[model samples]
Target: MSEAMRKPETNGAPPVISVRGIDMVFLKKAPGVLDGLARRAGLPRPEPVGVHALDGVDLDVMKGEVVGLVGESGCGKSTLGRVIAGILDPTAGTFRFHGREMSEMSPQERYRAKVAVQMIFQDPFASLNPRKRVIDIIGEAPVVHGIVPKAEISDYVDEIMLKCGIDPAFKQRFPHQFSGGQRQRIGIARALAVKPQFLVCDESVAALDVSIQAQVINLFMDLRRDFDLTYLFISHDLGVVEHIADRVVIMYLGRVVETAPTAELYANPRHPYTQALLANMPRISTEKQAFGQIKGEIPSPLNPPSGCHFHPRCPFAFDRCVAERPRLITKAPGIAAACHLLEEAAR
Candidate 1:
């Protein structure tokens, strides 16, 4: 990717997706009949508790840019993607697409915005309707969105399947008949059928074999070139993220800890958490070294550790780290991290 395209500010174009202070909280339990009756009867109800899925997260994806969102499992990577894809609304935040705030959009504008951002899930088979044929699964959306005329849906679906590397002959087959990799391709095709400008690929290839993962990753690059698509690729695979992402965002316990250009981050990680993640990533080396691991378990989001979420595991944790949360400060032209060490070094 060209520098101009990677950084939208150079061209003065708004990011394809701009998120600020995004927070997603899910209720621990659904309300039952008694809870509802209590509310209706004006009786005292127990306090509602929530899982902090995302907390004060911020991000930006320039047009046609692929940003890798990497974190350990249950670290809010998928939750952040779902919010960006419009599948789940954040409890608090400002989400903008092409300079328009989603919250401020009129009904028609919101509908169009929703259609423009699509998500491809990790479980291809589960995401697809088991009984629906490939054609219906991929064709129905474009028809409903008026992207294609109902009469031309078949031809459109065929064209899409072929573009996604699936055979047009299998359009009538149900998802169950296809292999895992093929089912993932069908999911890709269905997302593309809607003519979306952005896609949130939440562990899109994690279920596939290593060989199949390569094919899917290449397909994503091809589609980006062919369709002018921007992506928020969420995954825990550091190797895969390094290969495909132009920039990387690191998350831990529902907070963004570091973000920088991919090469810069890999070559010179700033935050201790980011450094630990990269240190543990498996890489082939002639001089053997034991695979390192970050100390301590990740704190629960429900009751996250005070101040820096990674302080308990961070090797460089200090009094300041335990008492005060560090702000994401700019260390270089394109690098930012939330760590007290950087602040101390500057001081």
Candidate 2:
């Protein structure tokens, strides 16, 4: 085992949530009989392929911590978010919340868990019902779960809206009546209505304009202070992730390549893939030399590269990296990376 695969010492703080060895696979739809027959006549085989969305991913999020999950599109970031939110069952592995296994819970317990961990989806407009009033949308969860009476639902909705920077009067309007930023605020209000301890924010601000994104980001921070909320903030935008995340996990080809403090990871990214990603970030001045850009397209999840999944695109890949899969191991305190270059550097 490489030094990078070794576990780092913990500071005695228990993680609020832990995801161990998660694997998700989606089988491709079967091809038609004609296509199968064509394959017999020198055409490509019609065998069903599997998309490995999350391959043995392990993650730990400490209590009250905001962890950013960043990766390119199709890298399985959103899939991981859904799994953590209990919206999608994993093909393998276990998810635990506060030391309790989530999969083993009863139906009532599962409902409680769902209420405890809420989701803020990317498109606020699509997430909210077009015909439903803001109050109905925001208060639905609390009312359904018996957290508040129907008579009190309006009051609870108003309070949450105010906290999320939306006016109480707007609660009477339909989702179509609100602006994009206002709509997102309504989404936040709805998530907050459940009084969730943890939130899965899957590209929550990606659909909004730059100005709106900042507003929503600030609102999330303020709510964290007021409500003590922990977040699994998934985004493709590194700038947004850096602004909010205490720790950041970089994923590539459905696996975590590196995990570290936001500042440390940005300053000294251990994995070559991470370095390539950071290098592509837009710089303010032309005087600054361009960092190394990542070359080549990402490998398809249906047919991912063998050994280290990133070997095909990694600039520093060696012969060993082509044949030996690297495991996420600690390189520094609270920092873990899965890369052959980091292992060599550590040695």
Candidate 3:
């Protein structure tokens, strides 16, 4: 295996989540409005376009490690997270938990895998049901999953609530009753109730204010230590990922472009897309900064460019980049990038 594909140093243990050749393609919905417009114009109905969300993605996240997946809004980071969290099945891929492929697992084993992995969604308020009280929201899963007895559900909810820094006294209150941060805490409590080993945190702190973001980030770190939990921290915020991630993976236009140890990736990005992303990131410097935007708006997923998906936006794109897809080439130990420039440099 290439260094980037190798599982983290875990004393011979297999990766907690290993997905290979993952591809998520969503068919475009033909809205009623579109059909009405077509009829009014006397044109044929439009064919459904396939929105390629993920393209041949491979990733290995080890036990007790934080892997930060950073990309632009529509670059499939969220989709990849959801795939790992078992929310959405990919169009093509092999999902392997530990050493066992998900396809080979029996029903009982599949259920156990589902319980072992959990997802914290981007919108806390939208994720929580308005009709359910806080206690029911957090306690229901555990009771149904047999993690806790129905009679002890309330006390069990209270324990997790305290651990997540949410006040259990407000158990009877609705989701709208708490602040954004508290709602997020409730979401965390719900995920923890199942005693999950891995968490797919999709923009978990993005909605919070700066101060509240810090609190939530710290809470994640504390929880990791306390519970020995592994995390797939998906976010668009480079700064936040730099602070909390051990390794960072950068994706663009439905493809993973670069990955490396957090400090090294930040200090010396190999791919042009990674360089552009880091250059535009807001920095705390007294010196004046010149933020250079990546050229062109991100291409639509409905008709992604041929060859390398990022070729249109990459500053270093050559004729070969326009004609041939680049596989990730190992740049240095623990670092790899998918770029034709690196391949040319090797020759």
Q: Give the winner by TM-score.
A: 1
Off by over 4 Å in 1: 1-10, 30-47
Over all chains combined, what TM-score does candidate 3 have?
Answer: 0.92
For residues 1-347, write the lDDT of model 2, one tens digit per residue.
Answer: 23232222236755767999999888787567888788789777746678999999999987778899999978999999999998899989988887778768888887887789989999987999999999889989898889898888888888898999999988889999999999999988888898998999999999999898999998988888789888999999999998888899999988999999998999998888788888897756758767657778988888888899888877788898999989898987789999877677778
CA RMSD of all predictions? 2.5, 6.1, 5.3
Candidate number that wins on lDDT, 1 or 2 = 1
* Estimated TM-score for each candidate: 0.93, 0.89, 0.92
Clashing pairs in 1: none
Model 2: clashing residue pairs? 4-329, 5-329
Native-to-model Cα distance after best TM-score fit, residue 296 in candidate 2, in Å: 0.5
- Error of model 1, residue 223, in angstroms: 0.5
lDDT of 1 at 133: 95
Error of 2 at 70 (Å): 0.3
Q: How accurate locally is residue 156 in candidate 2, as Cα lDDT from 0 to 100?
A: 85
lDDT of 3 by residue, 234-308 (tens): 999999999889899999878999999999999999999899989999989999888777878888887889888
lDDT, model 2, position 316: 81
RMSD of 2: 6.1
Q: lDDT (CA) for every model shown?
A: 0.91, 0.87, 0.91
